[model samples]
Target chain A: MLTIHCPCCGVTAEETEFHAHGEAHLKRFGPGSSEDEFEGYLFMRKNPKGVHFERWRHQYGCGKWFHVARCTMTLEVFGSYSAQTTEPPQEIMDIIHDRRPDTAAGPAR
Target chain B: MSDPVSALKNIFDDTGLVRVSEIGPIGMVTLRGDLSDKVLGKAAVAAGGVNLPEQGQCNTEGSQGIAWMSSDELLIMCPYADVHARLADLQEKLAGSHALAVNVSDARAVFDITGDHLREVIAKLAPVDMHPDQFNGTMFRRTRFAQVPAAFWMPDGRSARIVCFRSVAQYMFDLLKDAAMPGSEVRHYA
Candidate 1:
């Protein structure tokens, strides 16, 4: 089984520990943008041959969102980083924040 | 009065901060989103009562904490008394957002395992490293323990807290018990 080093988890884990999140660095469209703009953002992808950055989740391990740079054909991982700090679409950001941990301390009893 | 450590030991038969009783007070919450989203950081700080810890790390203050379960999901743990209400509040906050949050508090149970040689016992069951430099403090993971679905959090080098669904608690406990048994054929069990 292939082992990948998770930048966030800081260890080499079995491939089963993670899930591929697809190509990274997607383009963003402005509000009320044209259909072509939306289509480009939605349909365009760079299936690079080497050292392409992509998104991945530690599914069976540390459940954190992070990015990985790897070779498409060889599946050799070069590096990984947290998705929270990476650049993503604003719409995607809005959804992510909506699910963040609530800080209001519960009643002390 | 007794020594504080002894007193705590008496009150808390289990190790680690989260405890599991015969009838456990288990709380579980599932946080889902693309971590690449900045809003995920904001919402995680808002809903989890603490900023999501570093990748593979868990942060617990007072009675609550957050565990990184996967890139798109997290598991939150809190006291049994207030978990329901807290989950409801979190759901309401995410109501209109692009992300989705689900409360699975009733679906799982938690067990805290500490003391020396805990890592040795764990290594017997999982393929991950249990060394202090590799899997301590800033690490969390979901893997099979005793062949049951389980999640693990290491707050420090010497201790770990494990969680499993209630349906499989007995099976897991049996495995742990067997592993903990001394002088058994399994030389790895510590």
Candidate 2:
């Protein structure tokens, strides 16, 4: 069982304590946007085999949502962070890169 | 005002290793604000008669308490009869601020479990680290308890108080009774 830490509550508990919402840092396309842009925003998702950014809700704890950096292949978690920001914090990216040096450099999404 | 009734009408059971009681129609205010804001703490104490609790902490004095529920939320507890008055006072004090205080007493239920080896009963249902070394009276935890969301805190080493949605009061009570049933002691926290 995966153990996840909620950055908001600072509690590390079993993954059952959290709910995975999948993917993170999604940009919304509104009514004025092109049809393709809206469609892409609604249906397109990344299914990376390696480092991936995802959103997790601390459903049982603080009831706050946060971002998690995890490796899809090994299930190794890099870090959990605040969900208020548009991108993963620099330190989290640094940690992810440090562990998976072969992963492509992250740019602002 | 109509006569108040608790979720479970104040049920009590003592047949298990621990005694469980559905404590009351306890006054609860869901306060959302910036925890670090000085004004927020001042208003909370004024309304609840307790100081602001630190992260995952609970502070109580007399019939009132304040528990840190999240980074942006605190649950202020007071006597049931004083709920509306306290909430009004809290709102007046926090006017023009980015804060919200709502009465949640009727929408929630509270249970008090008292007996020896307090942590063991909670460990059976919650994923929290209930070991005595990691948990104590001053700490508060919100977790999944038997497939439902609940929050709990110890008033002392031998007693704990839990809060869950009113709709789940019966389920929570049943789960607590089963966990505290005789012959179920794991002795992990002993």
Query: Which candidate leads the pack in DockQ?
Result: 2
The sequence of per-residue lDDT tens digits that candidate 2 reaches over residues B62-165 is 66899999999999999999999999988998997899999999999999999985688889999988878888869999998988999999888889999999
- Kindly report which residue pairs in candidate 2 clash with one another: none
Model 2: lDDT to the true structure: 0.90
Models 1 onward score TM values of: 0.59, 0.93
Write the residue-wise lDDT of candidate 1 on A1-109 in tens digits: 5567776656577666678878776657768989998887788776655445678876665655677655566765555666765454444333334533332211111
Q: Which ten residues in a row have the lowest lDDT in candidate 1 chain A?
A: A100-109
Off by over 4 Å in 2: A105-109
Q: Chain B, model 2, TM-score against the native? A: 0.96
| lDDT for each candidate structure | 0.63, 0.90
User: What DockQ does candidate 2 score?
Assistant: 0.85
